[model samples]
Target: MNLAYQAKRSHLLIGLMSGTSLDGVDAAMVSIDTDEQKNISSVSLKGFHYVPYSDEIRERLMALCSVETARLDELVVAHYAVSEWYAYAVSQLLAATGVSAEQVDAVCTHGQTVWHVADSTPFPGPNGMMPVRASLQIGELSVLAERTGIPVVGNFRARDLAAGGVGAPLVPYADMILFRDAKKGRLLQNIGGIANVTVIPAGAALEQVFAFDTGPGNMVIDEIVMLGTDGRQRFDEGGKIAAAGSVSRELLEPFLADPYYRLAPPKSTGREVYGKAFVEQFTGEARKLGLSFEDTVASATALTALTIAEAYKQFVFPGMQAEEVIVSGGGAYNDTMLDMIRQELPQGIRVTTSARYGIPDDAKEAIAFAILGHETLMGRPSNVPSVTGAARPVVLGNLCF
Candidate 1:
């Protein structure tokens, strides 16, 4: 069968995304149709399902994320195990939607990112020391394809990285396909474990778009909540803990001073910079100030909000003024976080969730991967060179059949 021909027509694709949140796998069943130019003409959600990760799996994955604790043996075991988890998610999605594996065209997955180092670090090469940018995502695509009996498209970051790009914020190309407008410049802000923004200038072409990770989204706040409650709570539900507490400028000031905030676009970061160790240090500073648990959570939430607003003020506002900030991902549900972000942003800019545009906030990323997977099958270059700082635009994802 001609995969590209099939992709040009209407097709059903399931996108699976397990973000840094480590909460669960989101499976989005999307119906996509491409225009004569092979650009997405119409897209709609058919069904959505989520599979929560067990405590044991979460612990194992968390261990793999840290360099100090990640072992080769564990990585080998978890790689296949995570594929099983992804298969389970696909099965559950099929069951929920009453669809068959043969009926679907492909399974697009953005495997769980364990470690993402977008910045260059010197490492021993074949000849000598060389600057390398590396990232690893661990769900095996072959295993997922075998279990699901459908072709799989995944590891979407590797090709971009190979082309001298940061290999992230890969969703900007998809964001343009889904949210771009002719009259209004929009900022697509996704607040997952890490918060990233895609700036789509009004009526801009794909080459004109750009994006970068603003800073920690729910990552730092979730860590603080877990630390404060002794693992009793994984997150501050509805931002209630933060709402109940006070923001300590003492703690917020230092977090705002993080050098990552000042970095130019085409950048990305993950648990590497703001993971467990960073949270431990943050908690130590909070203790030095004698701050309460709620106060610490509040301050961390403020850091997310302020950093995002600051990124926009410094980078986005000077060139393209976005009329709206459309938020998606786990952070969209955090009322206190949303309120803080709104306060920090300038006047006349609207803040809203992706749901307002008919895309579920939680399912937006999953749906994006589905579109990306379709592009891969159609032999299209989906990576935005401007957003990723790649030498050139390139098709992303490794296909497994």
Candidate 2:
């Protein structure tokens, strides 16, 4: 069945995203309506559910992200395991929403990103010196399609990478549709495992969008909490732990000086830069400096705010006059993180969450992929050349029926 043809009527899509946090799969059931010109005039997120990864499953997936010498066989098994979980999430969504699989237009998933390197790093090449950039998102779409009995669109980044793009921050394209405002210059900031911001000038055209990752979000802070509690806590719930401590500039400056922070826009990053290894090294040095556990977590939380503020000061604010910074993802739930960002940024800017508009902070990313799948089904290009540094705009995602 051709998705585009079926989408001539209203389309309902389920977007699944398991972010670098390795927490769980976020599934959003979105109803979208497109005009004859294939422009999405309206979209509604009818349902949202988060199916958490069991401790064992999360351990396996996190190991895949950072294991010293993970075997290919292990990678293969984890991939299918993730796919089956995604299918389970889809079933759960349908059951909760009272929507049948037969009625769903498609299930679009971003899969689990075990590795993503978007810069010109030199790796072993066929002959000699070659700078290659690559990314891998596992969870077999064919398995998802087979299990769900619905068309699945996965692998949404390869074509963009092949066209010379970073294949990241793909959510900005969806930001244009989901959060753009004609009167207010809005900054859509998603603070997931990795933090990223998309700047949309008031009534800005697609080309005017500016976006890039702002270092670590919940990952570093969460890691510190996990270590502090010996894995008893997955995150710093509501920023209480962070609030209990004081931000240490001495410890925070090193994180700010990281080379990744200085890179300009059209850039992206992941756990590859701010994951377990990075957290362990920073925490080791913090303990060596006699910093308390609370202070260490506080500093990491402040790093997220300071880096985001500095990114805006250097890259975004000068070019785009943002009225409000609307935050999303797991970080939005952290009151301390939000307060730090609000204080670090200029007073003129107001910090809030996507929920103020319509979408919940946690569900925004999943919703974005759902919208992207709808665009792909409509035969419309979804990746912004300026945002992802692609050679040109291209329809993203691979279709599996």
lDDT of each candidate versus the true structure: 0.92, 0.89
Write the residue-wise lDDT of candidate 2 on 74-166 in tens digits: 899988879999999999999999999999989999999999989878878789878877899999989999999999998898888988999
Where model 1 places Cα greater than 4 Å from the true spot, the runs are: 1-8
Residue 192 displacement in candidate 2 (angstroms): 0.3
Every model's TM-score: 0.98, 0.97
Can you write out model 1's per-residue Cα lDDT over 164-218, one digit (the tens) per residue? 9999989998899899999999999999999999999999988889999999999
Clashing pairs in model 1, backbone N/Cα/C closer than 3 A: none
Model 2, CA-based lDDT: 0.89
Cα RMSD for predicted model 1: 1.2
